[model samples]
Target: MVELLAGLSENCVRLLDVAAAGVLLSDGRGVLRLVAASSERTRLLELFQLQRDEGPCLDCFRTGTPVLVPELAATADRWPAFCAAADGVGFRSVHAVPMRLQTTVLGTLGLFGSQVGSLDRSDLDLGQALAHVASVAVVNERAAADSATVNAQLQHALTSRVVLEQAKGVIAHVGDLTVEDAFRVMRRYARDHGRRLGEVAGDVVERRLAGRDLLEHARSVDLLPEE
Candidate 1:
């Protein structure tokens, strides 16, 4: 991810002839955070964007679309804070490209130009291509992470199931009850105590919870008939 950000910043400088480049990514909480920049000045400016909450990057991220400002002076009324701050830092123009997948925007890539003029069609196309590639990488990475989490949860559920079955057998032998009754008692105890069934079952199997306790809880809850 770090390498990707660095490449993005460098490519923007080379291909767009911008004075500096920076990337800002959403924190998944509707706030843009600077992740990378081609130079120290650009990094500082990007950080300022977060503090002020007004910049081409923020606008692009919010709209899930590009924001091209050919002249900073021309946008001073629209983005006063951003334009003033950017002008103070020696930038005359800025362009922002959204890193997006379909309608979802993940971030923005910002370009700072020393002179004011719009990017040619070729430059705009290249900028979009870069943003597209970055978006795909981010989406794929997130999908892989989600898949791993699902796999881990499935494995834990399987282990819990095995432990629950063993607990049912133990309770049946200890309480002189059928396996079905034992399982019912365990489930009732867990529900009454606001604990996970797997946790209650593990305790029963380890003898941490006595068989008498399980029977008492079941009777208290009217989940099992008296023998």
Candidate 2:
């Protein structure tokens, strides 16, 4: 994945109307991390964005849409830290394209340049195309790699699914809730308490976690439906 991201960022600089480029990809849970950059300054700038949790890539990631900044100076008010940082690093413009395929957003492809002009429509289109290609390639590579563990994971998941369902039924019965509400309640507890859903479900299925107790937890967290 790092190799792919590195290559993609390099290509964005070499082939597009940009002086530098950076790539930021999200983990499975949507936390963005710096993947690659075309230059040292660009790398540091990307890191700054990650640390501050602002800038074009972050905005694009949050909206799952492209963030095109034709002129950094013009947009200083919108992203003060980012503009100041870019100026410090000698970047005058930025264009952030969403690295997404369909509804799933993988990350963003951020193009930067020393000049302060926006890319033409054609250039922007090409940038979007490159980002899409990178997204597809990354997804395919991951799918291939995950194939090795797919069987084992599937077996465990199938067994866990049964236990999870049984636990849901138990919670529903004890809480006087529908199965759907029972599932939401269970998931909320696991997430809030820093436990895995499957582990908590296993406990409930094994009678380790009582359904009445689960219901009480939901009520405490205000996760229960209003009567």
Each model's backbone clash number: 0, 0
Cα lDDT tens digits for candidate 1, 23-118: 776654445667667766787788888898888889898888899999999989888988888898899999899987665667799989999999
Instruction: Find the candidate with the highest lDDT and give its number.
Output: 2
Candidate-wise lDDT, in order: 0.77, 0.79
Question: Could you tell me every candidate's TM-score relative to the true structure?
Answer: 0.62, 0.62
Query: In model 2, what are the clashing residue pairs, if there are any?
Result: none
lDDT of 2 by residue, 21-92 (tens): 988777544577676677668878998998988898899989998888989999888889989999998999
Candidate 2: residue 77 Cα off by (Å): 1.3
Clashing pairs in 1: none
